[model samples]
Target: MTSGPDPAEEHSADVAELLALVARQIDMRMPEIVREMRDLLASRIDDLGGDPQLVEMLQASIEGNVTTICHILANAIDLESLQPTTAAVEYAARLAQRDVPLSALTRAYYLGQSMFLRIGMDEAERLGVRDRVKIDVVRDIADVVHRYIDWILQLVTGVHEQERRRWWSTRAALNASIILKVLRGDSLPLRGFASETGYTLTQTHLGVMAWSDLDADDPARQHELDLLLRRLATAVHSPAPPLITVVDRSTAWAWFGGARLESDALARVEELVMAVPGVRVTLGEPGRDVGGFRRSHEQAAIARLVALSSPRYRDRTVVSYSDPQVALVQLLTKDSTTTATWVREVLGDYAAAGEHARVMRETVAAYYATDKNAVRAAERLGVHRNTVRQRVDKFEATLGARGVDPLQVALALRIYDDLILDGGDVLPS
Candidate 1:
């Protein structure tokens, strides 16, 4: 070297100096690179607030290398010589060691470039760059940017599926908790639960469903019913737990309960029942508390019976217990035989023969209406005082004289009228 530097040694020294210079430049640019990455990530994260999927994808991309990313960017900008700087090479090597995808890095690079271009475009315009140059840069940046966006979207979709599965698991657990409380007739402090579970508490909800069939022995039908119950639970929110019960297998008294259903929750439940082929479904009314839920379920059961008994009430997907006929049917069903017998005895043959039954029944109704005043009874019946007297006399005779006690007769007549009007198939004795 003292005589004359060896060619190989000289060349090696020059290469080392070039590599060191490149390393220094990369080190010097580290702050800017980190700042750019942070800004890009922040913007993307802000755009996807609380979106678990987007967060995961972005994280994956940041942990990846920039080789493929750099290649893609170079291709878009028509610059093939845009090799990775020392820092980028190091970053890629670290990511590869960690087993992260290089495509994720490419995605990050495009994202960073897009943000840079946006800021650069404004500065260039302020500095009065020519329109042609601005357009060319924008087009080049945009080409790569679109690819990056596509990559982000794809990554987000995958992440979303994963997040959805996680949320579904959480939801299933929450639902199970609520259902356990419901079975025990206990109320949940939903606000507290929501806070603990990190779920929105503003919208509270509940739902119910039921099923029935003629062939109770059909195992296939039972399996289908079980599947339907599971399907209903999942459809409302993914990975939901079963909230259904077969209250009475013989009568097909199946039921479901849950929270967070549509405003027309009952209708939605009925729609599910209707969709089930061959199986009869009855959707109960929607409600909040467990007690209210029980009432709604009872109503649905009554509605199903009414549908079976009367064609006029048939094929109704959602049977509201509030319907006049349905309510009457429920009332009669409470004590049908007793009610029928009472009706027959009160309005028997004698009362029907002389129209005394009608007069006395009307009189008693009016008396009760007027708080048991004979004067008011006569007035409302539009009959003479003695005419009302004659009718009362005939009623008393028919009711075995002892039964003519005005209070007793009045009570009986009232009960009879209620039973008959409510579709009790009973005639007066």
Candidate 2:
């Protein structure tokens, strides 16, 4: 027309026309691509056997063209060559988003097959870039994404396990601390321990003692002992509260305070001990204060020793200080056997002399037995009121004439009884 319409203007018009044509083609193809992608992804989801609701949501999003799949591909793909069809490009975008380990393999296979099908053998062969661009590029990108996702998942799982173990360790340590505090005869901070350990402090304090055969072959006895301590703790309650402690593998100690003892607490302890063969219990007396607790424990220890020496006493039961025999046993422990022997020897002659000697001995024995109770002694012997009076009179007369004090007679009788039962070889000589 006019020298082929100025060269620069013609070139510009040709570029604009080409760009418009490409935009129109994409607009027309996008709907079909979306529909195809939705169908394929739905089929894959069904094969995966995941939740139906999640699958349906993914299907609806794809069918609605909610994601910019084509744009995502445009950014990721090589632009030097003609791009693949929207379906193939969207498939690659979906695979990239999924970040699956084998997604690269799938993407490479699809890209290679799609390129082979779309281009004639001659064009693909001439490009010489087919293997590098189509196969290697997709594989390299997908591999990087897959490795990242795997690393992230592993990090999350590792962190979670570490936190769980720490939490458990903290809890165990707290429980042990609470138990130790109680065993030391210190008051338990129930609210504080409960808050820190995540355990209820109310009714948590208990008292227990552990005993094992001096010769038993249980290597796991320590573990068993802890279990027994926990069981006994659960069964007891107190205000200051009892706590568990391992005195040794063969012995454990528990203490409880601030709780009222039922009349049957001792009975219950005995029952529990009896059920376990060869186990013994030495229950401390209920004490209202620190001083009382010390005395109570001392009494319990002495009672246990006495009980061990006497076969007639029942096993696995509390021997209260108020028990008459138990009191006598404690008294004997407080005095020396040598002193008892001397007293018995010095008093024996007077006790053996006449018919009045028997009465005087009976009176002396009764005086000590009744704790010097003249009236109670009469009642115990089933004698006439005056007969006990007469016996007591004779006792004083015999001791008085011998230049012995009435108090000495009483002391000699106590020593005689204790020394005989204690199995001391020294007799009145």
Candidate 3:
């Protein structure tokens, strides 16, 4: 009938077009925006007495935020209500997991919202979006984000609270006691205690000391620490339910008992499990019997020390005691302060060379571990023999002839682990 377009429909169409333009602008700069937001959010979190762990966590948050925004801008009309996106809920849960006070999260949200508005307004002018719809589009976007945040916080705080109650339960005490006594080398019957602890002593076991890298356990994060343990146990398909003890708000000690342990268990775990936000897992080699149980636990404890005491290693989510070099490192770094001194003394400027230092030290260690055979070392390290030979020669050149001795070489390896692999960060305060 050639009727004029309905004014309401035309207005809606204009709004959608404006939003789509804004979304496009965001899409073009999303990568840079993510980096900026991560840094900004990290700063805000720090100001709020929160110890943020891992750049990866912030990266995930930014990606999630981008996805939600894109979805809303594309389908604003079809969406009847604002729903908390997966990323939003996960963000709240992670904050709770890190024991970051709820205020920190809300404060960060406000800061983020303010930044978004500023950016949107600036982009609106730059993009020459129509004035009639510009303010409305920004408001709609804000509304979506605000509603998502509110719904997510309400939902996840409940999850955190439930987990908190579970952590504080008497059952938690029983689990901790049974596991702690064994770790302390008490003479408990493996079977009897196994029945009580949901751990199967007869099966091969892998011990894990799972915890956050923060300086102290924040009570708020204990629930997430608890959940991290449970999730790991399930991911690995343990023969029996895992045995876990909450050591504190930031730390958990766990063991997975399996009828047969996978040879690539550590690799599998690194690929599948450790990438989950905010937790570090120090793993012991698989073993059996009560002795294996205790040994693996002790090894994992040593690996944790290596991981936490060095800033290089601190960033790593997984540390395995299975590697002979990692074990040797345990010997070198039994005392953190002393080992640090040794690394500085032995390697001199090279101790802090970062990745360069790791590659060289790894070459020498691989060489030594393979019985000083260059071909085998090359094979072991999966590098060309020439590369192995060159690194070894370079290592010797910097430290001189004495640096090549078996014992001296061993010390150098340990030093590298401390200064390079352990993240140069100081031990937790």
Give the winner by lDDT: 3
Tens digits of per-residue lDDT for model 2, 1-429: 446567667654543343233334444555654555545555554431254643444344443322222232323323333323344333333332232223332433343234322322222234344364434334433443344334423433343334433432343455566655643767766577556544444432223345666444452444344445443433444433244444544665555554444656545555665555555655555554444544555655666665554433544344444456776655654544565556655575443435555466766578667876778888877777577777666655554546656566676665454444333343231
The candidate that achieves the highest TM-score relative to the unseen native structure: 3
Please report how far candidate 3 places residue 136 from its true position, in Å. 36
Query: Better model by TM-score, 2 or 3?
Result: 3
Compute each candidate's TM-score over C-alphas: 0.34, 0.39, 0.48
Q: What TM-score quantifies how close candidate 2 is to the native fold?
A: 0.39
Misplaced by over 4 Å in model 1 are 1-120, 123-132, 184-290, 297-319, 326-429
Once superposed on the true structure, which residue ranges of model 3 sit more than 4 Å away at CA?
A: 1-164, 189-195, 213-220, 259-264, 272-275, 335-429
How do all the candidates rank in terms of TM-score, highest first?
A: 3, 2, 1
**lDDT, ranked from best to worst:** 3, 1, 2
The residue-by-residue lDDT of candidate 1 on 149-205, one tens digit each, is 555445443443344334434444565565455446676675764455433223322
Q: Which 10-residue span in candidate 1 carries the lowest summed lDDT?
A: 198-207
Instruction: Please give the lDDT score at residue 137 for candidate 3.
Output: 81
The TM-score between candidate 1 and the true structure equals: 0.34
Alpha-carbon shift of residue 118 in model 1 (angstroms): 5.5
